[model samples]
Target chain A: MLKLISSQIVSMNDIEEEILDRKNRKKSTNMILCEKVIGQILEEITLSEYDLIICTGEGELGQTYSFFSSLASKDHARPIFFQNSLHNSTLGSVSLQIPNIHLGISASNGFISYETGIEMALASSSTKPVIIVGIDAYPKELLEVKERIYGNEIKLKSGACGALFLKDSTSELFKSHKGRVLTDICFNTHCEAPTSREVFPANGLEDILRKLSQNHTNFTVNRPGGDSIVYSFES
Target chain B: MNPVDTISITGHGLISPAGIGLDALWEKCLSNNSVIKNGLGVIPKSDFSKVTQFVENSKWCKSIPKVKSKALYYSLFSIMSAIDSAKWIELNKTDTIVIGTTTGNLTSWEDSLMSYSLGDDKDQTIESIREQSLGQLSVEIKKTLAFTGKVLITSSACSASTQAITLAYQQLSSKRSVRAIVGGVEELGKLTIRGFGSLKLLTEDNCKPFDQNRTGINLSEGGAFFTLERNSDSPYLLRDGSTVLDSYHMTSPHPEGKGYQKSIHETLELSGLTKESISLIHAHGTGSFHNDQSEGFALNAIFGNQVPVISTKGVHGHALAASGAFELGIILKVLETQLIPPSSALVEQDQEIDLLLPRKPLEGKVTNILKATLGFGGVNSSFIVSRRDDA
Candidate 1:
C-alpha cells in the first residue's frame, strides 16, 4: 500500500502568464509543466524528503516540432531544441532545480504513460517517499501534421499532474492522510469503463488525483486496447 | 531457508554496429578494431538491408501493418533472434515486453516532417506517426508477438535499456510476470547526431574511453534483446540492479559520480555481493571528458584499482539507449568464454583514473560482472550479471 501525501495539477492556462513573460522562453512546454507541478508539490514537502522522482509522458512533441520545423525550413536548428526533444529532458530540467535527489527516471507509453509512471513507482523498492510527475504539453505546431497523419484534427491540451506517494512503512510523514491511501494497484486488468480520448497523455492520472482529492475511493484507467489499470484507494 | 528465485538471462540477440549476432559482436570487440568510422558507429548498410529484408520476409510480418521505422525493424529482428535463441516455442499472454529507446523511429519522423515541409504530406500518415511514438515501440513488438500482458517503454536516455532490464528483473522477482522480453533499440538520426554535436560532445576520431586524451563519444546505432525468466537454467543470471539520479545537472554527471556510487553500492547490496566479488565492471565510459572522469573517480573510489574495468564504446560506439543491452550481450559472452575484451582505442589511461584498464583481452576465471550506465538526466543504473555454475 502507498499513501498519497500530496498532489497538484498544472495546466497550460495556469502558467500562461509565466510562459509569455519568461526570459528563458526556449524551455519546452513540457519542462514548464513539470516545473509547475513539481513546484506545487515542493510547496507541500521539502525536496530532501523525496528519494525518487519519476517523470512520464508520450514525447516532447513541442520541442520535436520546433527542431523539425527548423530542419524543414533549412534553418539552423537550435541545439537546445534537440536537447529538449528527448523524452527525459523534462526530468533532467527538473533535476537542475532540485539538485539534492539522486534518482530520477522518465518513462513513456503513449496514453498509458501516467499509469506506467505509477507502476514504476509502485515497483520501486525504495523505502523513502517517491514523486511521480505525469506531464504532456499540446504540440500546437504539430496540429497540422497530426491532422495530415490522423486524417482529422486531434484534440490535445498541455497539462501536468504530480503525486507524492509514500509506502505504508514510510507514511509517518503524512499520517494524517491515512484515508487517502492506495490499497492496491492492478495493471493490465479488465476494464468496465469505456475507452475515451484524453486531452493529454497524462490526463488519466490527473483525473484520478482530482477524484482522490474529492474523496473518491476507486479509479480505473481504461487503456486503448481494452486493458485497464485499476487503482483502489481507501477513502 | 526459502529457495532463491534468481532471474536468469536465458538468451539474448545482438544487432550492433560491429555486425549482427553475438559472435560477430564478440569477435569485433576482441579484434581491437573500432567499428566507428568518421566518428559514427553506424550499422553497415549491407547488414541493415539484410535485417530489414529478413524482418519483412518473416511470417510474423504478415499480420502487422507495414511501417517505415528502421528502429522497429531492428527491434523485431533482435526480438525474434532472442526468442529463437531462448527456444521459446510460443509466447504466453502473461509475459511482458519492455523496450528502451532514445529516439524511436525519428528517422522516419524526419522523413515525414521533411516531406510535409516540402509541401508533400504523403509520408505524414497516422500509422507512421503512431509507429514513431516511444511507447509504440513496445506496442508494435507486442502486436508482432501477439502478447496482451503488459507493455512498457522507457526513454531515459542512455540508461534506458538498463532500466528496462531492471524493471523486468523486478517484475519476475515479484512474481508479477513469469517471463519478460527486455532490451533497447536505437537508430542513428540527424537529431541525435546534431544534438550531441551541438553539446560539443561528439568525437572527431575513434572514441577512447578513460584515455587521458579522450575527446568525446561517437554516436552509434543498433538493438539488443534478451529473454529473462526466474530460476531458469541459463548460464547468466541477472542477480539484481538499481537506478538513481544525481539531481545535479541535466547534461553533465556529478563530478565525483555520487549518483553512480550510490547505484553501484545499492545494486551490490541488493544482490548480496560485495565489490570484490565483481570480476569486471562495464563502465558507461562514453569517452566524454566529464563522463569518464566522473566514472573513473567513482570506480576508483569503490574498487581501488582491484577490478578490471573496460568500456566498449570505442569498439561499438555509444549506442545511446541501446548501449546497456549491447554491453550486457558482451558480458554474457565474457561469462561463456572467460576472456575479457580489451577497452578499445585506449592509448594512455588518464592518470586520474586509477582503476585497471585492460588493453588486451584478459583470460581469467570471470564470475560476476557489474554494468553501469549514466544518462542525460543524471539517471544512474547498475546491475550485476553472474554465471551459473550448475548451468
Candidate 2:
C-alpha cells in the first residue's frame, strides 16, 4: 500500500516569502515558482530518506520564456540568470537543496505529469519514501501570448502541488493526520473520460486527494490524448 | 508469477557522429577512430563560434520542420528507423514509448523567443513553445509515426536515456508493458552551449576522459533507439538497469562517486549478475575534471582493475541527455564484435585512477556489458546487456 505522508500547494504570491540569491538580480519567475513549491514540500516532509524525488510537469510559461529569451539574447550577451533553464530545473534545484535524497527524476508527460510521478513513487517505494512533486506556473507573459494569439477566455494562475508517498507500514503513523492511504493504483492507455471537472496540469490533483479521503473510493485523472489513470484508495 | 525476468532488445536504430543505421554505426565503432572535431553548424550563429560536434545532414535530416530543436529531427529519424529495424510494424495503442532528453526542441524554443522579441508575435503559437515542457520529442514522433502508444519523457541531463532504458526494464520486469521503446535523444542548443560555457565546463580541445591533462567536455548531439519486448532472437538481452542520485551537486558529481557505486551495485543485483559476470564497462567519461575523477573512483570501487572501461565521447562527443542512448549503439557493437574500443583521446592516464582504459581496440569474448552514465543534478544510471545463451 502507498500513503501520502504530506502535501502542499503554492501560488505566485508564495515567492514573496523567499529571500533569493543575488537580491538585486532578477529572479526568473519560474525560479520563484519552483523554489516556492520545493520549499513548501520539503517543509512538510523530510527528503533525507526518500529513495526518489520524482518531479513531473511541463514548465509553465514564465520559466519557459525566461530561459528561451535568455538564449535568444543578442550576441549571446544575456548573463545566464538560471543555471538550468530547462523543465528539469525544478528537479535540479530540489536535488541541490536536499542533497541527501537517494534519487530524483524529472519527467514531463503533458497533463499526466503528476500521475506519472505518483506511479513512479509507488513503483519505487519498497525501499524508502518517495517524494513526488508536480509544479507549473502559467506566467502572465504566457497568458498574454495566448490571449494575443487565441483570445483566451478563462483566466489562469501559476500554481504548484506535491505529495510525499511512503510505504503503508511507516505511513500508518499518519492515518489520522489528514493524509490519504492507497489500496491500489491502476494505469491504462485505453481512454476513459472522467465524469469530473477538468483541471489543468498543476492544480487539479486535489480532486484525486479529496476523493481518496473517503472510506472507500476511486478517482480517475484524465490525461491529454484521451488516456485515463485511475487511483483507488481504501483507508 | 510465471514471467521470466529477461527483456529482449529486438532491434535498434541510430543517427550518430558515425552515420545512420545500426550497421553504419558499427563500421565506425569497429574502426576505433573518432569522427569528432571543432566545426560550425549547418545553422548560423552570430559569434560563429566553433565547437566539437557530430553532425548528420541529409534528406532524412531535413524531413522535419527545421526548427531550432535539432532533437526533433534527430528523434524523428532515429525513432522511425528503430521502428523499421524492429520490424514491429504496428504500434498498438498500448505499447510504451519513453524518451530521455536534456533539452527538447531547444532550437525551436530559442526560435520562438527570437521571433517574439523581434516583434514577430504571430510566431508564438501553441506549437512554437511546445518543446518547453521537454515532452515535444514524443509528441512529434508519435504524430509523425502515426503511433497511438503512450509516451513518457525523462530528463536527467546526460544520463537521461539510460534512466529511460532502466525505467523500461522495470516496466517490463513488472509485467506492466510487454513492449517498450526506451532511449535518449539530444541536440546542441543555446542554453546547453552557454550554460556549460558559463559553468566553464567546455573544453576548447578534444575531451580526453581519464587523461591527466583533460580539461573539459565537448558538447554534441545524437539519438538512438531500441525496441524491448518479451522474447526475440535479438543479439543482446537487457538484463537490468538502475539509477542512483549522487545527491552531490547541481552541476557536478560527488568527489568519491558514492551514488555511482550504489547505482552500479544495484544494477548488477537486478540483472542477477555479479561483477565477475560483467565482461566490459562503458564509462560516462566526459573528460571534465570532476566527472572523470568521480567516475574513476566509482569504477575503481566496483570493478577495480579486473574489468576494462571504454569512453565513447572521443568519437561521439557528449550528446547530453542523448549520450546514454547514443553510447548504447557502441555497446551493441561491442556485443557483436566481442571487442571493446580503446579510449580515443586517452594520453598518459591519470595516476589517481587505477582503472584500466584500453588505449586501442581490444578483442575478447565480451558478452555481459555494463553501460553507466552520470549526469548533472547527481543522477547516475547503469544498464547491463548480456547475450542470451539460448539465442
Candidate 3:
C-alpha cells in the first residue's frame, strides 16, 4: 500500500513561494515551476527520508535548444550550464534545495507527464518518502485550439509544476496523516476530453488539486484525449 | 534485503536493422551479418562528418504501413508488433504503457525547422510544431490503438528504455497494475546525425565495440517493446534494475563509472544474486573510446573476469533508447537458445579493457542475464532477467 504524504501545485500564474534567487543559475521555465513546487512542500516531507526522486516532462527542450544548438557560439558555452540543461537537470535543482535524496530520475512519456509521474511514484514507493515531480509548459497554442473549438475566453496558465510525496501505505506516517489524498489514478488514453464539465481547471495538476479540494468523489480531467488520463480520488 | 520480485517478461517484439519481430531479431543475432553499414550512400550525407549514411528503409520497415516520418512509422510498427506477439489475450484499462526515446520525432521537427527557415508558410511551421514534441508520437500511438490506459514516457538518453522497464517492473511489484508495456525507440534524424557528427561521435566505419581502433557510434533507428504481465507464464523475469545519475557531464561519462557501479551494485543486491549465478552480461558497447573505457572499468570492478560480456550494437547499431529494449529482445533469444552470440564486427578486441568479447558463440544454460546501458546526462541503468523455473 502507498499513500501521498503531501501534494503541491505551481503554475506560471502562481509561484509556490520565493524560490532561491540565484545570480548565476541558468533558470528554465520548467525549473521555475519545479522550484516553486518543491519550495512549497520543502518542509512537509523530510528531505533525508526520500531515497528516490522521479520527474516527468515533455523533454529538456528549454536547455537543449537554447544552449546546445549554438554550443560553439562566440559566447562560449559553460559546461555547468550545459550539464544542468539535460532533461534530468531539474532534479539537480531538487538536490540543491533538498540535498538529501540520493537518486533523482526524470521520466518523459510525452503529455502524460503528470500521470506517468504518479505511476512511477507508486512503483518506487517501497523506497519510502519518494518525491514525484511533473512540470511542463503547455502549448500556449493549446489555448488557441481550445478557444477555436469552444469559442470561450479562458485564462489558462502556460505550464504547471506538481509534486507528490509518497510512502508505503503500510508505513506509520501514511496511517497518521489525515490530509487530502489521491488514489486509483487511471489514465485512459482511449477516451476524449471530459465534456461533462463546462468549467475546467487550469492544467493537469491543477485539475487534480481542484478535485481534491472540492471533495469530489469522482471526476475526470481532460488531457490530450478527452479525459484521456482519468483518476478516481478520495478526500 | 527482501527477495527479488522477479517481474516476468511474457512477450517481446522488435523492429531494428537486425529485422522485425522476435524471430527475425533472433535469427539476425544468430547470423554473422554486420547490420552497421557505411551510411554514405543510403542516408543524407552529414556536412560536418564523413559518417552520414545509416540504415534506411531497413527490411523491417517494409512490412509496416508507410508514413511520411520515420519516427512515427517505427514507433507505431514496433509497438503493435509487440502486443501481437504477446497474444495480449487481454489488455485491461489497468495495464500501463511506458515508452522511451532519446529523440522523438526529431527528424520531422528538423525538417519543419528547415522549411520555416527557408520561408515556408507559417502554417507549415505550425503543422510541424504539432508533431515536433515527443508527446506527438504518443498521441498518435494512443489515438491509433485507442488505448485509454495511462501512458508514461521516459527520456534519460540511451538508458531511457531500461529506466522505463525498471518503472514497469516496479509497477507490477507494487501490484498497482496488472501489465506494463515497457519499451523505447529512436529514429534517425538530421538533428541527431548533424548533432553527433558535430561532436565527432558518428562513425563512418562499421562500429567495432570494445575494439582496439574503435570509432564512435553508428546511429540507427528502431524500437523494441515487451509485455510485462504479472504472474504470467513467461520464462524470463525482470529480476531487478536501478538508475543513477552522475551529474558529471552531459556528453561524457564518469571517469570510473562511479554512478554506473552504484546502479549495478544496487540492482545485484536487489535481485539477491551474486556474480557467480549470472550466466552472461549484455553491455551498452557504443564502440566509442571513452564510453567503453568507463563501462569496461565498471564491469571489471564489479564481476571481474567471471562474466563474459557481449555488445549487440555491432548487430543493430546504436538505436539510442531503443537499444536497451532491442537488446532485451536479443537477450530473450540468448536465453531461449542458451547461446551467447558473437560480438558483431569485432576484429581486434581492445586489450586495454579487461572484459571478454566473444569471437564465436558460447553455448550453455543461461539461468540469469544482465542488460545494462549508459546514456547521456550521466545516466547509467542495469537490470537482470532470470528464468522463472530457476531454483
CA lDDT, every prediction?
Answer: 0.80, 0.68, 0.67
lDDT of 2 at B22: 60
Query: Compared with the true structure, what per-residue lDDT tens digits does model 1 show for residues B120-211?
Result: 65553434555556766665666665666777788889999998899888768766678989999999988888778878999879999999
Candidate 3's C-alpha runs over 4 A off are: A7-27, A43-45, A49-57, A64-86, A89-98, A109-111, A138-156, A169-178, A189-203, A228-235, B1-6, B39-68, B117-121
Give candidate 2 regions above 4 Å deviation: A19-48, A60-64, A67-74, A77-82, A146-154, A168-200, A213-216, A223-228, B1-3, B39-69, B123-127, B233-235
In candidate 2 the C-alpha lDDT for residue B107 amounts to 68
Pairs that collide in candidate 2 are B68-B107, B68-B108, B69-B107, B69-B108
Q: Model 1's DockQ?
A: 0.56
lDDT of 3 by residue, B1-391 (tens): 1244456887776667655566766776677466667832122223111111112233222232223456566566666566667786555677877887766777666555445434454654546644545666776665555565666777777888988888788878877777889898887765566666766787898788889989888888777788887666678888768877665655788878977888888888878898788889999998889899998899999889668898877777888878899888888888888888987778898888888778888898788899888887678888999876643
Better of 1 and 2 by lDDT: 1
For lDDT, the strongest prediction is 1
Question: Model 3 Cα displacement at B46 (Å)?
Answer: 22
Q: Local error of candidate 3 at B282, Å?
A: 0.6
* RMSD in Å for model 2: 5.0
In model 1, which runs have C-alpha deviations exceeding 4 angstroms?
Answer: A21-26, A51-56, A147-154, A174-176, A183-198, A207-219, A224-227, A232-235, B1-3, B56-62, B115-127, B389-391
Docking class of 1: medium
lDDT of 3 by residue, A131-152 (tens): 6666665334244433333333
Candidate with maximal DockQ:
1
Docking class of 2: acceptable
Candidate 1 overall Cα lDDT vs. reference? 0.80
